[model samples]
Target: MRALHAPTRRRAVLIVPGFEERKITKALAAGADEVVIDLEDAVAVDSKAKARALVVRVLRELDRDPARSIAVRVNGLATQWAADDLAALAEVSALDSVVLPKVEAAADLVRARELLGRHPATLQALIETPRGVQDIDEICRTTAPLAAVVIGYADLGAALGRGAELPPQRWAAIQDRVLLAARASGVAAIDGPHLGIADNADFRGRVHWAREAGFDGKWVLHPGQIDTTAAEFTPNPAAVEAARRVLAALDEAAERGLGVARLGDQMLDEAVAVAARRVLTQTEGN
Candidate 1:
């Protein structure tokens, strides 16, 4: 059976316009954990077909790194081009996953997989609309091989008619919902693309928020944002060491027939150990 987990870490996601072959080529070599060729918002309506064809050709031609995940963000399931996009992508064996935009229900995932035919690429859902967010629990509960769920912040904001600058608190609530559902379903949770590429300060703050809030990763629009995402998402040496200490403490407690232990000034329990192990898991291969 196909694995439900992602093939690699997803701390830094570099997404390029699918119609731009040069950009895609550059993205592949940009050292992001995942490179997504975007066929939806990034490509113009007239360029959709071209984007689809080019993405297939590029995936077929390039010698992809097995360690770095490669994905394609196809047009939304509601769009006219989605079926064709899925059908075309079925032939690209190198694809690790397909990011399905505006997924509102569990049925959408099943439909996308069917449209994709025999291709084994995993599905990543983009929750952009109110319906999508409302049905997120059901979407996550689906039996489909969903590797991750990403916040489509820009589109979601626009759809909610909240204008561009929605408050951080509101975004946090939405992100928490996505994160909770993803964790419960055992899938990765990704933050949406930060449009303020030129605003380094704001970008770094958002990355920090994502990390602290337990998001698996944040989307990095440019190579400049990549390093920041990588740094913030990757667990530091101290954190890894702390995780090891926590596990050791738990083991020691177990040997003593105790249900809890003390680590420095804090009390350690199974819950604490779970968090610590998660930190170490994030450090793997970093």
Candidate 2:
């Protein structure tokens, strides 16, 4: 696969308390690019069924034109919550995707894809378990409506018995692994949030680390994290301007039917075209 970037807007997601219309509306108004009406961890186990019942109605209400896409992160199939989760999804037209937690292999995706019926709600395979990490590539590149592969690092850390840290922390390794798989397959990849909700410096550092690891965007667990994710993932103005130059050069070259060209003083081949067009696309999104 080739190196890649896309005209993606920042994917800052807020995990809201499920079964509640007010909380979902509040999170979206706070500027999260996507508000996840969570049926997984945020909803208590005792209230899971009640919460699941409200998801379809809540999504249909919030999922509006030019609004942030609504998603439901269903509890794992191994648990009691998944059956109703699938049922709620089948009833909703507003839901854009379903996030499957602790996905360990392609089979999990295959099951979710089947369970989603013929609805167009996409899949986001979350790689959080040790087995999920090991099977990251297989799970992420499935021939299904996989929106992106995401990481839940804090849970992953607990599972691995390690506190969160950067590179080589098993959590970071899997984050990169999932991103690599997503990029190779031309899908998207999102980084899990830094759990230090109050430690701004540390959280920003973690976001920076995720940026370098090739994650397209990140999960915004707290209200404070949303602005930072948007700022970091938005294409830099300088790069967007440069991409305009690249686009112009390509145009002139194409007029002469030339296969190779230069953007400013640099040669622009197929590889450069890919990277340059990404920036141009970014500019358009802005």
Candidate 3:
């Protein structure tokens, strides 16, 4: 039977090259809540077998708890390697999720479901093409076993040609579609990666943009990106303290049988109290 998808647990996910288990191990130790060992574009066509073997080995060693997420990004159904890839993945109990790259329709997920059988791992989609974006709604709403919808910035921009920037406005339609799909279906909508590998300032700006756009978090390539993404996505101490104050004042007011209250110069409402709780909850896994 199908199962509930694993929840997105971390403030950030580090996307590491699957063939390099060393890098994967380093990233995991470097504060990534999880790592996406990529076996597709990151691995050369000839090294697919090696990458799979490494990912499986890595999976065998890591904790698979939802709280300590570890996922694998495999080649799509169109490739000769996908079936074998799924077969290998099906054996690992340490896998929290399986990322399906370049999914264009629900049929991709159907094939994935058929392949996963009773393994019960969640499906995370990497939206890397216009077609994938066009069909993203049905993909996100297809029911359990599906988790987050991740944007694939580099590949998507390449797919759309030279005019498309890293975080292309050209694909805004698909971006909104993925967001609506994820939000409507109660899943996290993760933003794609930033190609500015060495520019910390630019990367932070891009991540802030993703947060503003309502993305859950970013898929990062470098370990340097993780702390920045996590810091940006998670509520800071000031915000958390403010939230705590809002809730505390409201609780005291309620205890005294007061229907409304004001915290300092600001008038507090149920909305403010809830916002405080939300800020705290957002850091649950951080």
User: lDDT of each prediction vs. the true structure?
Assistant: 0.85, 0.74, 0.78
Q: In order, how many clashes per candidate?
A: 0, 0, 0
Top model number, TM-score: 1
lDDT of 3 at 279: 74
Worst 10 residues of 1 by lDDT: 1-10
* Deviating ranges (above 4 Å) for candidate 2: 1-8, 63-65, 165-172, 251-255, 280-286
> Candidate 1's error at 196, in angstroms?
1.5
Expressed as tens digits, the lDDT of each residue in 1-286 for candidate 3 is 3322344455688888888867888866767666788889889999999889988888777754445577888998899999889899988877778899898887788788678777878888888888887777888877547877898877777777743344445556667888888877767788877766653776777888877776778878788778788888888788888988898999999999999988999989977875676577667653
Query: Once model 3 is optimally superposed onto the true structure by TM-score, how far is the C-alpha of residue 180 displaced, in angstroms?
Result: 1.7
lDDT of 2 by residue, 1-286 (tens): 1111112444577777786767767776778776677888888888888887776766556546454556789999899779778876887777777889999988888898888888777788877888888877788668787877888777788888876554434455566677778777776788876665653877777777777666677887778788887777667888887777787888899999998897657888766666677565433543
How close to the true structure is residue 49 of candidate 1, measured as C-alpha lDDT?
Answer: 94
TM-score of each: 0.88, 0.87, 0.81
Instruction: Rank the models by TM-score, top first.
Output: 1, 2, 3
